[model samples]
Target: MLQFINPLLHKVIQSISPCVLCGIDRQQHHSLCRDCWQQLPWSKSMVQRQEIDIQVACHYDYPIDRIIQKFKYEQHLHFQNLLAGALLQLRLPKIQAIVPMPISNERLVERGYNQSLVLAKMMAKALNIPIWQPITRLQQHSQKGLSRLERIDNIEQQFQINSTSKLRYRRVLILDDVVTTGSSIYALKQKLEELGCQKIYAACVASAEI
Candidate 1:
């Protein structure tokens, strides 16, 4: 009789709590349940692209992409919290600052926020780093749906850093929401290098799998 009652007791507890990702019965309210958390598209290692090394938190596929769409397009801002732990879990080198890939003035006005900046700020807070915004983005068309070469062409000469900004360290980290053709970060890498930044590392929330 006691064994039969245990199953009912478990169900009662589960019903009172819900997973952040799936909304299924769970014990923690502010996080994903075990299974849902395991389903995140985690990247196993840092990847080298051209001259810069990039650290990706996860693969940009299926459920991962869906979550990004919700956060960025659907305006589900609270979902950013769902992503906090994973971002906090990422292992990054101690760097001078985390510089978020900036968006053009028009895009910022249209969207009312920069997704990359939000992710960067979350990471900076979690990692105890400062957010750097030395570079400003110029008006440009979206890079979505473009071929690799076209993406490169689209962002050419699109970023400008203030001539007066100065840094105390030689290394810096760049952050962004996504990495597709690697064009955006690569371009920023070149600019940072020109600014006397000896080494540039990058991280993004997700990336397209090869």
Candidate 2:
């Protein structure tokens, strides 16, 4: 009874609430009104990055880019629902679990959360799958002056297997808030492969120009 009532109550709240973007129209799609949602720089396509084809929901442009920056850096967690909704727009594959892009302990301490993990929690619940974190990320350093190869090498070293967990999933999806060069995803993928993931897939809320 509560389960049924919860959804209906949510729908009612959404119907009355103003769109997060326009702040005038009633919420329609994913906390946005019909106009705002349709205008969201949608991509809904696959992008090849580091030989991996990632499913992306939007082009990292306009309001989407700004929203992501706020959600990740500014602690505007209220935007998470809209961001998770964007990922839900993708045609995701069937996987046993979701692996959110891991952040360094240092970064987590500074930011108070791993943005990808927060989004992954929403996705895992919606998809009825477990959230898996088999990789731990070391402290991240800036790549401001590094060459491409050096940047890749630096990013690759950040991901280390979390040896404490014996649990492994043959199939999983890597969730990230954004994708640029895909260096981090590729690095993470290598680690997932080491863990014996047979069919590893990746998806992001938005993809930016490399």
Candidate 3:
């Protein structure tokens, strides 16, 4: 009884406590104060016109980095809600499924969970879209300093389509925590295309560029 009461009492106290990111009274469902949120650099708009339309969650810098680090490394699952809310700001097109990039089994064991998957799940729930886990990883290794051809070559035959027939003609929105050189998502795009997904879009929480 005391243990339960103590935790509840502490939560009540925290409810009124000042926000860590911004010096303001904390509010439910708000991790940082409005000032902090506004200060953080996010894409002015989610949509970026490209061959394949993509939706970006936010720019990868400062406060966003801090949040992602906490969410991924520290296992701060509560950040999912905050991230999902931030993601909703993006004016993404209607998506049939949210596809998360799958990590290798070795990395998954080390991390104990996939951050992209959690982000995708939250986004799917918020958007009322199905979360697709049919994508399977084909290869794993450090991609540093690899040429464009080398990177593409490395991933060839690495990812396998779980069931292209089932997902044929459905729109796929691929989610990733970060994008560098667009290699990772490129591989996913090829795999998704092989699965016969009609319309495919990529969404990354952060990109290496502004």
Candidate 4:
């Protein structure tokens, strides 16, 4: 197992752990060298789960952006594990299910992949939470340069429940790679509540001001 071998392998990684973001030598556990970690813009506090709960580790900027770009767009799949480990450090509450933000059919067709799904899988593995695919994108629209109010309006009718199967009893955690306006999670949370989910949490790797 990787965990069983990690202690011994750490010395090896220390010798060879090149920074995925900056190319510096790293002696750390997950990924990204020490210099890069220090330079990352971390979130200052843990956000509460109201109708929805949001937990994020960092701000979406600088080195975090470059790393996400590499992982999501450049096909660096290994970075997902690194991100999952980083998120684990946040000490989130016990969760029943991990639900990733669903990508629209149009976007999936254009990009040939779903980055949030990948991140959710990684998080699920790290957190030992079952992934529940219970949300579907109901529509698609361009979201470039949209204000917070505009984003809320655009997402109001954008999502729907995938099923009525045990949704009423599940304590779900919504997973995403990033959160800018929190509109998408809010919309999805509203829909989940309508379906009778008692507790909903939103977990993302980073957040940004938009």
Best by lDDT: 2
Better of 3 and 4 by lDDT: 4
Query: In candidate 1, how many Å is residue 98 off?
Result: 0.5
Candidate 4 per-residue lDDT, tens place, 3-88, comes to: 87987776786568787766766636577777766666877456653234578888888777877878877888878766776677
Regions of candidate 2 where Cα sits further than 4 Å from its true position: none
RMSD of each: 7.9, 1.0, 4.7, 3.4
Per-residue alpha-carbon lDDT of model 1 for 100-162, expressed as tens digits?
A: 888889988888898888877877777788987777889978777978777777786798876
The residue-by-residue lDDT of candidate 3 on 1-210, one tens digit each, is: 898999698778768866656657584444555677677678734444224456676778888888888988888886776677677777777778888988878778878899999888888877888888777885488767878789777765567777643645468888887665666677778877877777888887766562
Q: Return the TM-score for candidate 1, rounded to 2 decimals.
A: 0.82
Going through the candidates in the order shown, the clash numbers are: 0, 0, 1, 2
Q: What C-alpha lDDT do the candidate models reach, one value each?
A: 0.76, 0.95, 0.74, 0.75
Winning candidate number (TM-score): 2
Off by over 4 Å in 3: 1-20, 28-30, 46-53, 163-169
Better of 2 and 4 by TM-score: 2
Per-prediction TM-score = 0.82, 0.97, 0.81, 0.81
16-111: candidate 2 lDDT, tens digit per residue? 999999899999998999999999999999999999999999999999999999999999998998999999999998899999999999999999
lDDT of 1: 0.76
Q: Arrange candidates, best lDDT first.
A: 2, 1, 4, 3
Winner of 1 and 4 under lDDT: 1
Q: Which residue pairs clash within candidate 3?
A: 138-158
Q: Which 10-residue span in candidate 1 carries the lowest summed lDDT?
A: 24-33
